[model samples]
Target: MKAEKWVFGFIFVFFLVVTPIYWFMSGEIAGTFVLGFSALLGGMIATYLGLTARSFDPRPEDRDAEVVEAAGPVGFFAPQSMWPFWCAITVALIFLGPALHQAWITLVGVGFGIWALSGWVLQFYRGDYKH
Candidate 1:
């Protein structure tokens, strides 16, 4: 935590120094605006850290909280999925077909591609019976 504070402080100060140098060298309004906004952000962040550091508390109950058993098993075992391979083929077809100017073929491939992709991805989230 102390290291994190020092790192943030170093970054804040480094940015403060770099921004002004960049602004002066470039003589651009955008650079100045960026510098100003960065300084404001740094100040706000420093203020937040200062306040949080001064007000932190350790709770005994939180330190030694009780663990509760879950009502049931966490997840179901999903069946093997082959649709991912099919979706990959369809996606390849969609790209190749369109590049070859086969509009109808591309459209059909894209539709099936989306369907196969969703079915493949969502199979894991289904109930045991569905899987």
Candidate 2:
């Protein structure tokens, strides 16, 4: 985590220094904004990591331990389900409606999005049993 934090910190500083230099050289607004925002995001992450460092235990990677030393309790992942696909379709509809100037499509997409969200949240829920 320390190393990761430093890497992001470096990114923040590097982009911070480069953004103005880039703007002065190219005089382009879009690239300047991108670089500047990149710096902001990097700084945010580095700050977050730095602030939380005290609560975080040193991981195997930080100690340069073997990979097997870190192999434990990865995390929970949802089982297979079609809700994700349905959710993607709803997002497409949401964007497509505005793009095509059809308010009805966007409304439908929003409605379906609510349904998809509920279904996805409750997919693992089985009454009177472990989910």
Candidate 3:
């Protein structure tokens, strides 16, 4: 936690110092704003980490711990599924349709988005995972 705080703090300061120099050099508004926003995000992360508890138990990297010490059951992770990918495609189509001036594609995307969302949500309920 300490290391993370310092790292993000460095990032925040680095970006803060560079944003103005970049803006002065390039004379661009968008990139300058982006850098400023990046600095803001980094500062927020560093501040949050600083305010949180250091931790009751030290992390593995913080101590002289072996790989076997850390090796254990993590938790349940989802098995392979393509619904998320399909859902992303549907979102792209939804936005692309308006950008391209194609209403039909947007409608199709909406229909598919519903299917994707429901399929992802109910996948285990109807499948082998059901009990």
- TM-score per prediction, in order, is 0.39, 0.82, 0.79
Give the alpha carbon lDDT tens digit for every residue of 32-88 in model 2.
999999999999999998888879788887787998998989987876788999999
Order the candidates by TM-score, highest first — what do you get?
2, 3, 1
Tens-digit lDDT track of model 1 for 25-131: 99898877787777767766776766676576523232453445323466765557787689888988889886999898898998988899888877766666453
Q: Number of the top candidate by TM-score? A: 2
* lDDT-best of 1 and 3: 3
lDDT for 40 in candidate 3 is 96
Per-residue error at 81 for model 2, in Å? 1.0
The total of clashing pairs for model 3 equals 0
Ranking by lDDT: 2, 3, 1
**Candidate 3 ranges beyond 4 A from true positions:** 53-56
Could you report the Cα RMSD, in angstroms, for every candidate shown? 8.4, 2.5, 2.4
Q: Candidate 2: list runs displaced more than 4 Å.
A: 127-130
Best by lDDT: 2
lDDT (Cα) of model 1: 0.72
Expressed as tens digits, the lDDT of each residue in 1-131 for candidate 3 is: 67898899999999999999999899999999999999999999999987773645766865788988888899767788889999999999999899999999999999999999999988888776663
- Candidate 2 has which clashing residue pairs, if any? none
Off by over 4 Å in 1: 57-131
